[model samples]
Target: MSSALSTVIIIAALLAAAYSLVTALRDRAMGWDHLAALGVLEALLVAQMAVGFVKLAGDGKGPDDTATFVGYLIGVVIIPVVSAGWGLLERTRWGPGVIVVACLAVAVMVVRLGQLWEGAVV
Candidate 1:
């Protein structure tokens, strides 16, 4: 896995979380601004996923729990999409709250990915 890409994803995820949380705190509904920030995060995550797959396939060096790692990778990618959709449907401050949840999940998954990259078990 590429540490630099992972760091980018992690930082972006956290920033997304902070942005969403602030919006929620301000009692604002979901808007293009929130979507734009999360869109940037999603783009970075997509790049991270692509690079991750390349690394996994290249030289065959990966975590012991390959299935679990892959599962987390997939789940991390899905979270933002699902949460965004949910937010759009809800149409309230809860929309940003949903983003906060999604971003936090992605942030945690990024750390987990790093742990898995380092050969951590389970």
Candidate 2:
């Protein structure tokens, strides 16, 4: 895994979380901008997935628990898409609030991804 790319994903996830939180706090419901942000995050995650697979395929020096690593990657990739869908189901601020939670969850997953890449287990 590229540290630079990891850092970029982490930072972008954090920013998405912050933006969603602020929107939720302001009682702003889901909007185009929020969806756009989710779209951007989704793009980043897809890129990460591609890079991760390439790295795993090339060296096979990643986490011992392949299932978990791949699971996290897959889950992270699907989250924003699912959240965006859920957000559309409602017109309240809580819709966006749910997205905020999802963003934070993705951030945490990114941290875990780093650890797993480093061969940590629990």
Candidate 3:
């Protein structure tokens, strides 16, 4: 995985989290803006996943903990989608709160993903 891409993903996730936090603070339900931010995040995650898969396909290209890294990649991609669905189901401020949690999770996971890619054990 490219560190630059990982950094971008992390920043985007944090921004999304902040946005969701603001929406939740305002006592508003998740709306189109939140969904759009999530959509962008999902797209970035998908791109990251694609790059990870391509790297893994090459001979001995990924980290020693390949299985775990792969798991993280898949999880990062799925989290936003699942959270978005859950958020949409609730018509309350908690909906955006859910997104906030998801975005923060994604940010942390991306950082972990970078460490995994570098074979850092933690």
Candidate 4:
């Protein structure tokens, strides 16, 4: 729910997404650096999940639609893993493309999460 944390997540996701897109456009193979970035992003997301749960439990100021919030949180946590797995399976530029898409999705979700934390609804 902290704006600072949400901003960090959004910036990180945008940076990663841009990097992945550039790599994909260049037709480069998947590399350890990209994977490492994804790993870091995943860690940040996990931390966010923890903070979010604590805040939600204490204040209950989050989205009114509990199911949607939970779904978004779950999706946010799983994206990096799913993208990394799919990337590893292909060994092509498309692998990086998958990562790019995932990162973009994460960024958007972070924004939505912020809105939800502010008691916004669909």
Please give the distance, in angstroms, between residue 85's alpha carbon in candidate 3 and its true position after superposition: 0.6
Kindly report which residue pairs in candidate 2 clash with one another: none
The regions of model 2 sitting more than 4 angstroms off are: none
Clashing pairs in 3: none
lDDT of 4: 0.87
Backbone clashes for every candidate come to: 0, 0, 0, 0
- What is candidate 1's lDDT per residue for 39-75, written digit by digit as tens? 8888988888887788789856788888988888888
TM-scores across all candidates?
A: 0.93, 0.94, 0.97, 0.93
Candidate that beats the other on lDDT, 2 or 4, i.e. the better one:
4
Query: In candidate 1, which residue pairs get closer than 3 Å at backbone N, Cα or C atoms, i.e. clash?
Result: none
In order, what is each prediction's RMSD in angstroms?
1.2, 1.1, 0.8, 1.2
Candidate 2 residue-wise lDDT, 5-100, digit = tens: 778877887888788788889988899988888988889899999988888889847788888899998999999999999988878988988898
**Any idea what lDDT model 1 has?**
0.85
Q: Lowest summed-lDDT stretch of 10 residues in model 3?
A: 58-67
Taking the tens digit of each residue's C-alpha lDDT, what string does model 4 give over 25-121? 9998778988999998999999898888888788846667767777788789999999999988878899999999999999999899877766676
Winning model by TM-score:
3
Which candidate tops lDDT? 3
Q: Rank the candidates by lDDT, best first.
A: 3, 4, 2, 1
Off by over 4 Å in 3: none
lDDT of 3 by residue, 1-122 (tens): 88889988999999999999999999999999889999999999999999999999985867998899999999999999999999999899999999999999999999999899988889
